[model samples]
Target: MDSIQRKKLVNELISLIEKGNAHVSFKESVTGLPSELRTIIPENLPYSIWQLVEHIRIAQKDIVDFSSSAGSESLAWPDDYWVEPTDTVTDEDWNNSLQQIEKDQQRFQALLEDEQHDLFAPLPWGTGQSLLREAMLIADHNAYHTAEIVVARRLLKSWK
Candidate 1:
């Protein structure tokens, strides 16, 4: 793609990451949830809303870190990605996790916006990995889990 086209596409990807598409945006899905209800696991869901938030926070950080490096090592599956099941989430943990998510998201955006890196170029340490693919993965992963949180909240009547 030409420079103009690349710029537009990058901006669009960032926008989709932020606002979502044809579904509830992450901001709308996650915000306004009662802190007290964050740890309540409704029927059928394996993870509480706080657990979901923490999972996203952990996974997103891993992805962002991976994207910036040439290393191909994956985080320990299901272990590093999730926290221990808990009945309560402290205000500090909850707030810190969300803030980390926001900060990492901005870093991802900056990675895309950086003129020095080529989004489509394959990383040397990987079989075939690129920033473009990683960005989409993070966005899709977050959106899916954010929706899960929304559903759990709805089931628990914590989100209206």
Candidate 2:
């Protein structure tokens, strides 16, 4: 692809991951969430806001790490991607998780923006996964969970 096209694609991926073009962004979904509601699992829902937030963080970090390096160790599926149910979600823990999510997101964006990384080339250590594919995965996964967070907030009457 030409430089112009690559730049445009990078910009679009960044927007999809960071902006609420068609749906709520992760930050917007979790912003101003009441601490009391962070750990409460709404009726019939399998996860709390805290769990979703942590899962997003963990999963995104794993993808970024895997994409940035060859032969990086992959986390165990399901178990490593999610946090256990906890009754004690302090402000510190909550803020740290949020900060990590933002940090790792920026890290992945940097990788995307770097010209050295070929967006379409498959990773040497992966099964034909390209940076472009991982970028889309991150955007899709985050969007799905962010919507869930919004739904949970609505059910808990904390949305808006």
The best candidate by TM-score is 2
Q: In candidate 1, which residue ranges exceed 4 Å CA deviation?
A: 71-73
True lDDT of residue 135, candidate 1: 85
TM-score of 1: 0.94
The collision pairs in model 1 are none
Deviating ranges (above 4 Å) for candidate 2: none
Clashes of each: 0, 0
- In Å, residue 4's CA in model 1 sits off its true spot by 1.0
- For the record, the alpha-carbon RMSD of candidate 2 to the native fold, in angstroms, is 0.8
lDDT of 1 by residue, 1-160 (tens): 7789889989988987888886887778778888778888798889988888889999999888888776636889989899877878888888898899989999999999987878899866666888899889988998999899889988988777
TM-score to true structure, per model: 0.94, 0.97
lDDT of 2 by residue, 43-152 (tens): 99999999999999999999999998986788998888999999879999999999999998899999999999899999999999999999999999999999999999
